[model samples]
Target: MNPTDKNAITESVSCPAVFIAAPASGQGKTTITAALARLLRNQGKVVRVFKTGPDYLDPQVLAQASGQPVDQLDLWMAGETYCRRRLFEAARSADVILVEGAMGIFDGEPSSADLAARFGLPMLIVMDVKGMAQTAAALVSGIANFRDDVSVVGLLANACASARHRELIELALPKDVPLLAALPRDSSLALPERHLGLVQASEVQEDLELRFEAGAKALASEALAEALMRLPPVVFEAPFEDPFVELPSMAGITVGVARDPAFSFVYQANLDLLQQMGAELCYFSPIADSCLPECDALWLPGGYPELYASSLAGNRSMKAALLGFFAADKPILAECGGLLYCLETLTDYNDQTHEMLGLLPGEGAMRGRRGCQGMQTADLPEGPVRAHAHHRSISQGTPEPITHGRRQRHPAPGEPIYRARRLTASYLHLFFPNNPTAVARLFSPEPQLQTCDQSDSRSLSDAVE
Candidate 1:
């Protein structure tokens, strides 16, 4: 039976939704979305927030602002069915749903505009009009008229120099496209960013709260509030039963998850799916913790391991525990930074080398430019899985490749998945909802050995050295 069609219970719900987008990156989509969410929540409305693409950082800020867990909505990686299911579920309890777009409005293959058009949601384009006035309207007009399916309902002028600046831009905007709000140039309202993008919200919680409060105040004008309240309701039919209900259970399994500053790039939905499948998850820090929690399998997610390489390398007990875990032939799944942690050494962007777990025979070097990126699909024995690969570190070794990935933008080979014994290490971060069975089987108790011809399973000691 089709996974998305099994035991489907149909129901309809109304969710007033809008996609907060921008003309390009750094145009304040995330900031505006957070401000709007805060304003709506202040008005006593339950706001469900979502981020468009495969980002982990922006969602953190959105979640904090809405006081709710933010989910990602992507057309390719997350799939249309999954996106519909999430929208249906959010509509059940949320009075409004705000989706923060990725990059520019029409950036990638599955851009924010595509998502809005797919779901019949209007676009609230936020543009940074720092230098020009009438030219800003040309950009907004181009985005609004670029596609027939999607419509730009409103515009938010960000980083305006003065009241005169805001007035000029408002006058220049097309009559059809309304100017909802003009946020004055306030560096205090800007969120701190790092190489990967905005720094994680946890790192600067107090500062982020202040920025959100200021943003809300700037966006609390009567026009902005009225425009938000007047958004058309999104109506969709979906199965009443949780979509994850059909997934096969993994009873009696405990999955140890690495969760810390060094390994925090995990999707919340991934953990939720694990719980829904009956797997007990225990989180331990490799940077601060000395040992791994007892579990049947281990999952090391992607994060800023490069930034804390020395600390993770200094954690002798944690390194030993990881080596022992690999020796036991227990299942393990590592992505990006996790893959780096399993290597013998990690060279940061500054060219300093630090010892790593050495579970895999390789040394990962952080590069100034992105090593690999874009949507990736891996063909595994279990099944095909779709994910996104965004990293800046290159691993140097000849580990046997278990699955080869294909990139979406270019029809070229992508990241290679390395399998040694029960370990599945790769640069691609798998979206669990895409193929729950394949992911669950990765942690199944009864491990399946690879075919003799394709077998690259090596002894733990041999793999490390």
Candidate 2:
């Protein structure tokens, strides 16, 4: 079924919505949001979950809690119209919409408070009140009063020491604001994290469901339940017309996408847009699969390849298939971790070197520092594309770059872009829906096949073997 079909008949929807925000990062915003989603789901409420930034990991946990795919709601990266459409779509079938905010309440150019104010959704502040008493209330008060348009509905104290600690915070809060819940300090309640952020939900094996249940139990206090019930209903009116641009068709093309532990950082909307543009998508795992599926184009998304470098390095058949795919000059788009896989070698954080596909002229090193991050725009051959870059690894080599990428804030030296034959690789993960036609052209087969030999039947086989 096409994802675009569901949005054809637009209608007004009234769903209670709230943003789970925090004073800063590591203040239990994601934890509380996941817990609330699970608690609401257990209560027979249909919950729609969203992450308020260009985050990939947190949404996985949120999706697990809500039993629905969690979409991103970003003001700049995804645009306002896309966010409104997603909110309306979720509200159509959900009783509540829970959005997990990123970093702090007012950190980035378009913060969580910005989104809340735009949608008129109330904000529930999650403050880590550990090692502080009445000061926590001051922080919440400042966030609430800083923005006249945004409303702070309630406050939740995280990592509190004792009943006295919770009482102190509650007493310090303004009379108009209420203390919704107080979560005691518990190490087990915290999710595992690495340099990037929380470990992906897919990597967490065994007792996953039990972990989410424990998280819900940690936050599902009597006060929280009551506070959730007291939230005002939200009425969302449909726009005068559809907000999405009509996508052109690519009916005769197939795009094979890599999906596994090493390469799973794809945006759902990007995939949906590709499908809407009339491309058939096939998913294959590089870690387990022996060969790639036959297709006109291939996309390798970014993920935690360093964590599973050994397994990926050992996949000889898959490596050969990728090399052959590049040799055949079929269009392939790789980003970040995917770019690492295309390199000659990858050195993990442990300083262990592993062989890679060697399709691109570069070697990647997992330096202990973030290589680059933030929103960027690349001047591609087709056009300018908006993308995000977040990785801790650096590629060392000089390949002929197809374009230069400039970050939105710091337009320093442009980012490196490597293009070998029909392959385009970089650390930037392009949000395909932003320019569907350009993305479609990047994956289109007609341009690549114009130079191919018609007698090479093996290039069109179902699998390498």
Candidate 3:
């Protein structure tokens, strides 16, 4: 059958979609999902994978495995319309859609089960059966039966010890819920991790390719990868109207985006939205670049800045360029690790203090294992934009915040939104598509912002020297 035309989409489209979920976190969901995607991709199929929540790392891995651009589908952060539209667009061309669930199946407020039910996608529960046998079947059975709205179609047993282990799980499962596949316990299939989560895919691309090939080869002999091709396609309807169609135009605006090992936690959707609104994105590296690109504004997304503190601090010319940008009152939006880079000082895990951009009067340091992560709305002076905070670092002695992020559930505020001159820095990473107008306002230059106190402006000038 011919694929649907991109420009001529009707009310709805259909494609086989699977929600790859787990009983809980660390069930090797990323490994299984990436491997499954790779398996199908190797068979000359178009696989579009999406991470279910505000995740950066998993999408990176999945995107590389599937050889397709991956997106994040969240009911709250991106909204139901965005999710539906994304699915519809994918269905137009993709052979199959795979959404890797976050944390657990029934984990968050709008849980993986909630999203699965909302879209009527079949669920494939992936469980690591290394230490257990029949109990795996019990857990899968319970999860399958727990919600009437969600349809549990099959199960993939990860890290099964032997044929005997696979037989034990298969025999215990219900007749309707068959064992799709049993991936062996192979150390070669394991992805590396850091303090945050899985290390960035770029850092381990060559090894990842080998792992993907190995994983695909592993799943090729199983029923799970083949079953994906035969699953019934779910109908995805397009939104009646594009809510952001009338977003403020960012014509003539060139935003310098920091894209490097230290600041790579950017959502593909955010970049897409910026271009859609007529803004040109110029990518530069804080860790490598000696000067800023000639642009109207700047955006620093989150990543492992703590890991590359020395490199960022050592780039004196780049630091001077940043100070000049700040002194000129150019707009800059920094999130999470970006927030850290703008601080006066940053202490690494080794307790080594490095001088930062000093765009804000603060010091950032790692908090060991403790971290803050949750969905919130950043109450920016431009407008409220939906965002989330996930970081293991903290800032001290920062200027007073202009506003605070409103928590998704609690009445109290979440992360502090600090505004230093034209810089809107925070630990919260804003989802641009959630409020394109607000995001446009953020990147657009404001003349009133030039009225920053004389002392602060002088300090920025002094730092430039």
Candidate 4:
């Protein structure tokens, strides 16, 4: 059945909820949210972890913290109905639903506070009280008063040094507000970092679990657990409708998707939507997998392909298989990290360059290429394209003359601001369901300036790779 039909089968549900927010971005929302989910999961609760914005990395950490794939809840990106559906789905099996907010509570349009107010989830404000004492109360009070809709559950004194520090901050809070938890300024719990926020959980891979365990134990206590229990639930009706932007399904063939630790940043919803639209989905790992599955088209989603440069480079069979697909001229779609792997060479952090599929001209360069974030909408010479950017590697291609991207920054809320080509490669991971029509066209039989060879699957024993 198609996604629309399958979605109709989802039974709506809602349960106890808590929104981890802060006085501001540096107040440790991501850290606290991860720690809380980890602790709650340790308590045998099925924790449904979520983020309140279009963040890819934080959700990865949160998913690890709860031992489940995390989902996003953004009014701007996914809209209210879709967010409601995700919430409903989580409530079905999740014993507790924890949402990590972006930046300050009231920051960003369709802010976390807006989502919280819409869902009725109580907010626990975490403030980095390192810089002030009594003024902390004023800050929390300002957040509380800034919007009457957002409920102030309690304050957690982050970066506290000692009991005296916690006491002073606790006393400073309005007498009505309580100090839920106090985290001593322990440097040991600090997560790794680089140009972009915390090292994307995937970049850390095997070691992330150990770090998550330590952070959870360090942040959680009896008090935090009690405070979580007191958090008000976001009351809502049943059978919550899905909030899909609705893309029309085009007549198309099966499309294989590459998914593994090396290429797993694809939104789960995209896969679901693709299958719903009648295209078959075949998944294979380029790290060790030799043969591509039965597919008409192929999609390589973004991930830390640079980290596994050597392994992907050595995957001779995978390389050969991809080369076969190129021979077939199959419609191929790839994003950021995936885009990197498609190039002739990918440079690692140590400045070592390794050979990759040379179908695309550009090479991934480790040379410091900062200032690459924000949204972009492509007015592709082929058609309209909407995408985002978040990468560090600059292109070192011989003919890297703007194949198809208009650099966009500080794009207004809900604005289509960037465009690219049929073969778009950007750091900004996108959800196809947001634009079903374009998504449908991407995989449909409709021919534009380019077309894929219509062919049947080849045998795996002697597959392309």
Candidate 5:
């Protein structure tokens, strides 16, 4: 049989997996998921955790709790084959696989429910049950019975106060769906947050460690820890061939990636794709390093630029280095916070202004609680790459956009894509694996333009599906 064929006899790997989801956002999903991961890790079990959408902060926290590298799993952004292959590979070595969902269970286009149902992974709904008891059972029952395709194995009632609260929820639950555990309302279990989502793990690792231990002890009680261990192993099939095996090579091209507290939003998968395509990667810090790494191209991903605006402005040598690189016409990709850093001025949340790199004649200002966020396609001159926009800041007085982002659902144009010399700056974060060819060209010295397309994985998707 052809190894790449749909009828190919592929080997299967089995491992226990659970999709940790919630009724809606702000329901303590990350906290409970991290607790469960830490609880299992304390028992010496290798736990592999996957986040269900485009996120940077939660994955950092989850990775620390699980003691494993976390990967994002999205059906629309990453494709079915990519998600499947990641699961299969993790299953081979992982004792338990935990996928933390984004937003509500069935919120997005390819929602958490869609991924869970497709893979036959049962869901453990985490909801805040402080306000009601029997109502909790009602909501969970509706979610479980609403979709026949999805499987609901149990419910993890969060923020339960007294024994009476647990008893009311337990008694109202259907026999088929069990109440796994009732976690107490403890402030210590909560993860700190800011304008974005959770605080970066590196900033408060010690505090997170204390919270993780507290959460683990809570979940370890009432046989909840024992119940999670009993989840049946799910079978996963391996991909026939690696997707990047045939990607265009960028040999001898060294790309500099900004990686520090100020610009740490670079995707692991993006770096992986670059290396797989024969490109060399070097890391440099814009906040700490005075000079750019000796490389052919530069990538500055999004981060909390507003928080470090003063420090970034104080680093005069770094600004000069960046200007020199821009003057040389080297390719520089800046997204969100990176775009802010490139502007002439940036206003922080406190309204404090600081001078920036001035590579672009624009100013960025932080807007409290008001921002744009959605999936879009960067209609780049090189080619189209699937991307997303999530930022609280807005830009002013920049050059006219060379092109606009194609919104995922809306008919209107999304964020503006600005091109100054060889630099490509935008508020949208590009998912490189979606279109390796486009990304390769973006970072190359002379990009050869082509007809715009979503990705180079259509044939792979067809074969896998």
Candidate 6:
């Protein structure tokens, strides 16, 4: 596996491959994915990254690991045609493509297993072997047998205590399947964590190569490469033929987007979609830069802006930009983290209140314990908005006066999640297709974007700074 060999068929050809995953959620998928990308890069192989579900943070980390922007792979969330085209387009340029899984192998609607199967990408199964030995073999055997579309290429056992532990697991799998690598129990390899999942890659810029290099050295054993050689190659799907989304004429309109490490929760697709709609996206650091992007609309998506509340308070320029931007009465859309940033002040984990954009009339602070409440939805006076609560901090800012929506298909009460004056801010992010009118009406300058209609003239907000 000489990484530098340019003519290596599998190495040179942009063949698509996936990390088919999960024995469960708490497995070391994220850590291993990052390590693999770094290791492969060390081998001089070009790598591109993709995550299985509707994840925002991990893709950021993976983008850093792969040295290329990461994209999501869920068919429904990203649109099936979009995912197919992105996968192949990335593969055409990359030497090897790594798509990480979510939850256990078969968790979530359109599970990681389904994504791998749908794209015909080979799978690598990651099993956390913390408490078991020979039983680890039976664990993977059952998972491999559970799904027919998935092919377990190799098993990387995480948290194995010692070489003896690794040997014990290997001996158990000789007749069953190939055991690729065994990762030692090293807490240093684990990243920090809070109410949300693992702290994002942007939060920490330390020398990660130390841990990833060691993990790659340990995992890159002859047995692992041998296992990989045995797995049959995957046939890639052809490039999709969806008409390229037309780029809207940007004549001279600037779209202000909330940025900075504190407010970097926007999706690239949303930005791309806006660009196609004829607006130039401008970025302003909500944590550092004092001025907002001299653009029309402001998009504040979800992120952990509260985690760095003290610094956000110290930075006066961002606050001034936000206040001024809102004073101009341009259209504004805020999601979870952005919603918190739009508040009058954001109290950090330490209970100290820091001033924010002040677009909305409320103050929010951090809370604890009640984390990962699955999904949520809110039925406002306009229509039903869909979302989920994936934060550790709770706040008492503005309250919703309408119906609450649950994650399930059927409707329920008390699920309402967002409300603001001519604005909608919720922890739940809708697909836009679900409620395009509500989204468009929020941007309509008809003096009453607050009023939603089945056929309201959807127009861009006049960029205000």
Top candidate (lDDT): 5
lDDT of 5 by residue, 260-369 (tens): 99998877788888997789999998889999889999999999999999999999999999999999998999999999999999999999999999889999999998
Q: Which ten residues in a row have the lowest lDDT in candidate 1?
A: 456-465
**TM-score, model 3 to reference:** 0.93
Give per-residue CA lDDT, model 2, range 213-304, as digits (tens). 77778766545755766788776754433324356567989999999989988888888878877899999999999999979999999998
Candidate with the greatest TM-score versus the true structure: 5
For each candidate, what TM-score against the reference?
0.92, 0.92, 0.93, 0.81, 0.96, 0.82
Which lDDT tens digits does candidate 4 get at residues 1-465? 133454545534557888889868878787778888888888898998888776677887888778998877776555566676677768777888888898878777668899999988888898888977778878888787788788887898888878888878888788667788888787666677665567778668567777677777876653586567655555544333333533345445787788876687767667766776667777899998988887767788877787789999999999999888766656677777777887889998888999988767767776564746554444433333345667777666434434344434453432112212334444556666555445655555333532332221111111101
**What are the runs in model 1 whose C-alpha is more than 4 Å off?**
1-10, 239-245, 449-465
Task: Give one digit per residue, the lDDT tens place, for model 3 in 1-465.
Answer: 112344333577888889999999999999989998999999899999999999999999999999999999998888776787788889989999999999889999999999999999999999998889999999999999999999999999998999999999999999888999888889999898888999899999999999999998888888577787688889987654532235557899999999999999999988887886789999999999999999999999999999999999999999999999999999999999999999999999999999999999999999897899999988666667788999998899998898899999999889999988788999999988876656777888873322232222111001100
Better of 2 and 3 by lDDT: 3
Give the number of colliding residue pairs in candidate 1: 0
TM-score of 5: 0.96
For candidate 5, give the lDDT of residue 96.
93
The TM-score, computed over Cα atoms with residue i paired to residue i, of candidate 4 is 0.81
Candidate 1 per-residue C-alpha lDDT over 1-465 given as tens digits, one digit per residue, 9 for 90 to 100: 133554445557787888899988999888888988888888889999999999999998999999999999898888776787778778889989988899888889888888989888888899999899989888898888999998899888888788888788888888989888888888888888987888989888999899988888878863586687787787866633433445657888999999988898889988987887789999999999988888999999999999999999899998999899899999999999999999999999789999998888999998876566789876666666678999887889848787678787687788998988888899999888776667777887667533433222111111100
Against the reference, the lDDT scores of all candidates come to 0.83, 0.80, 0.87, 0.69, 0.88, 0.65
Off by over 4 Å in 2: 1-11, 240-245, 448-465
Worst 10-residue stretch by lDDT in candidate 2?
Answer: 456-465
Question: Can you give the lDDT of residue 463 in candidate 5?
Answer: 30
